[model samples]
Target: MVLVTAPLIGFSGEIIWPIGQILLPVKIGDAEHSTSTWMNFVVVRSPSLYNEIIGRPGVRKIQAVPSTAHRMLKFPVLGGILTLRKQTIAIGSTLIEEGWRALCGLLRRNLDIFALKLEDMTGFSRHIAEHRLNVREGCSLVRQKKRSQAPKRNKAIQEEVEKLVDAGLMKEVHYHS
Candidate 1:
């Protein structure tokens, strides 16, 4: 997820939003099918507030089965080999599997995506805030009073931020009156 979010920086060169750093496992199938296909799984992640803040959205369909007793019905594996269930087939040169192609195209055609490295920026301008606090004293480790920055961003930068917000890459935070 972090690898994915690394490229979502807007025109101002800041991360659109933070994302979960991991992909979650999705289990498939229910009681009747469970015994037959026990090892089904998918690499998936839940859409979060950050994802909403950004442009991408996702949905999950869970396979839920009610409690029921199974009789003696069972499935038997028929293949000694070449079974689809156990076979790991590699789909060659598809969009996802061939990231190099997509990256090359992006580099050649839309360099702006690479130009604004979100990870290099200090912060984002939209749906965001920053607070500075001082630490001091012997063993106190207490935080000093916070200092607030000007609520208004530069007009040009704000315009860029608005563009990203309009594109559904960020939420409008109403922290200021």
Candidate 2:
């Protein structure tokens, strides 16, 4: 196969890191639910780091990608990310559109916010592309890790995740952290 470049369009994202961890579900004893492991395995947790940075209000967006260390491990599963082209913007507009609809449906919100059509997400995508929202710059806790079920929530979480995956709102990806 061959590779090539193309033009980019719309986008959107935050200006700084988030207040969570990229959790990797690890099975301990097969007792059902699994425990989680974090990448970097740092002493400085994300919440405190977020608190430190939150004082900076001018931040517009934030995102994180695989660290060079993690990516260089060079596992087969990491190919999609390892092959990421810096010049192109990968915006999940359909995901945004679908999420907006789902949020509106569940909340039954009828505010001006409801007027955003799925197609319009492209206009927003421009901002993400132009403004560096799609790029994972510096160190960021931009991605949120979620899983199938918990011992408490059971199938509810699984059902929700399945619905999201089916709707193309999210993807089930393999991550080390």
Candidate 3:
């Protein structure tokens, strides 16, 4: 990889010179359902809350749709749609609290507002808001070929899926041909 000085603007309106750039293969989702794409990552010397940030190009390559309201990311896979859910809530770093007690009391009082666990979820709805994917004229949906897995891996996958079904996070559905 060749070293290049790339200037990037920060969120705070500060200009930064990147240390280097490298092309890497980034894969998202699990083994059964996933997509891979080669991305050019710019190494920077700065402090950030996030470890790595995938810009719009990387997301477009994976064809992922992220929803802040739903707190999840969805994308098309071989068999069906793959969804990734956010487990933790984001707290503003600028938030001022009197002390730990005040912060704890505030969170305690609003415990019902956040879904901290599977048990905290009240219900599930397929339709949260109106959303549509615009397909270009004459463009066709590409069918992905299913990859075969080892017997042990398949059994482990099935067990993990059953756990999700039991937790009300996933359910088996029969699609009519």
Candidate 4:
């Protein structure tokens, strides 16, 4: 009897890890069958592995099943039959490939929310208050406190303030009243 040894690999949290393994003897179009046509497994350690196997000819479905029975079984231990269930399958490369770019873009967009400007307390507070007003109208006390410091402004400072206001980080208020 010829036994094939499968390598053990780890799936890191949220990070796409790629792996190279033998292509399972499953065809991509065989997912419609009722029997276990999509039972084969591919060990992955990176995102490229997903790209490699998903484009192959004979590959049917690439799914991620939880590595342990402890995840699925909820009965008094032996009550549930020991069986493997397919959790989710990798569909295409759009989400996997461009995922990092999406995350970085989100971080850059919200960078002002996390930044603190001690020198420009009034402007910083106005920015924070305006953002809070736009997002949560009930939070007014914090914003009022932030706008208490009335400091002198210059052209460069005014430009920076206008930039934040234009970017939706601060509210534009006219001093007509």
Candidate 5:
């Protein structure tokens, strides 16, 4: 069975787990009584297909695929815009995984193009690129420091801050109210 895991988000902007399991039904159920025993596995299928199946007593691990349709619908508008602009947006189960992989691949392949576009649009010269790179490097350093729980590299951070200040990207702050 194909298994895909993803972080689940609900209607109220909260994250939840909604695992989907695709399996064949062994025993049949009628309109009035709806319960089944599949391959010695007993399950109580709900009236609404959209509702999650809560495991009953004696049931162990339940295999599931991430619900792609519900997830896509729950994403914020900015995420939708990003997906739409990529030309690899897919809605259904068959294409959803492939679409996301393609989108990531496209972005990975076009990093230089994106950088050039940003530089051109912002009217930043080569000197400005160096400053931007410095700022990015410093940010990475700070992130590494935070992750490692180590003391800050004040000298290197100060140097990068000065570079950014010279490039007009940042200004010195004396105090905050």
Candidate 6:
């Protein structure tokens, strides 16, 4: 780390001075599927709210797509896509004291209602939610023309379906046309 001065503005209009900057090798995702790059981090002499904040530069360097709603970071790796789960959830900044506590308490109380992973969720059932396409009355059923997909795409789709099936979220079924 070298001595440098760069002012960083906080969320609440607070100016924070960095102690220095260091070029460190940062790795993202698991060992089986991952990406890495040397990043210059601005060292701050203050407590951190998050583990690490990767800005647009870092995200672009790794070619990652972060979805705040899904709470996941996705990037393309050698063979397939790699996804990293984020534990933190964003809430309204205006929430304070009782509101924050109440929200946390409510989540804790309803822990069973939340499924962090597909495996944690209950098996799929028609009772939970169901949908049916609107078909015209007295219309003959027409089968769409059969199409073939690329081998790579077929393999990927099979893998995803298998994963869902193994997790009990999906089931194999056959319908006679």
- Please, what are the lDDT tens digits per residue for candidate 1 over residues 21-116? 444443222322321222222212433223222111211122222211211112222332110111111112323434655556655774422324
lDDT of 4 by residue, 1-177 (tens): 123354543222254333444434432211222212333344554444233323222222333232332322111112222222212212223454356566557547654332243232232222111211133545443324433333554664577677656654446554321
What is the lDDT, from 0 to 100, of the residue 171 in candidate 2? 62
Q: Mind giving the per-residue lDDT tens digits that candidate 5 earns over 1-177?
A: 323365544332345443444554432122232234443222223222232233332122222222333221111222121111111111223335556677568658754333322223333323311211214322433233433323465765576567556655455544222
True-vs-predicted CA distance for residue 139, candidate 4, Å = 61
Q: Indicate which candidate wins on TM-score.
A: 6
Ten consecutive residues with minimal summed lDDT in candidate 5? Answer: 81-90
Ranked by TM-score from best down, the candidates are 6, 3, 2, 5, 1, 4
Q: Estimate each model's TM-score.
A: 0.19, 0.24, 0.47, 0.16, 0.21, 0.48
Misplaced by over 4 Å in model 4 are 1-20, 30-42, 45-53, 56-177
- Stretches off by above 4 angstroms in model 5 are 1-108, 112-152, 174-176
- On TM-score, the stronger of 2 and 3 is 3
Model 3: ten consecutive residues of lowest lDDT: 125-134
lDDT, model 5: 0.34
Residue 17 local lDDT, model 2:
29
lDDT of each: 0.32, 0.30, 0.65, 0.35, 0.34, 0.67
Q: Is candidate 2 or candidate 5 better by TM-score?
A: 2
Ranked by TM-score, the better of candidates 5 and 6 is 6
Query: What's the CA error at residue 87 for candidate 5, in Å?
Result: 22
Q: Tell how far residue 55 is off in model 6, in angstroms.
A: 0.8
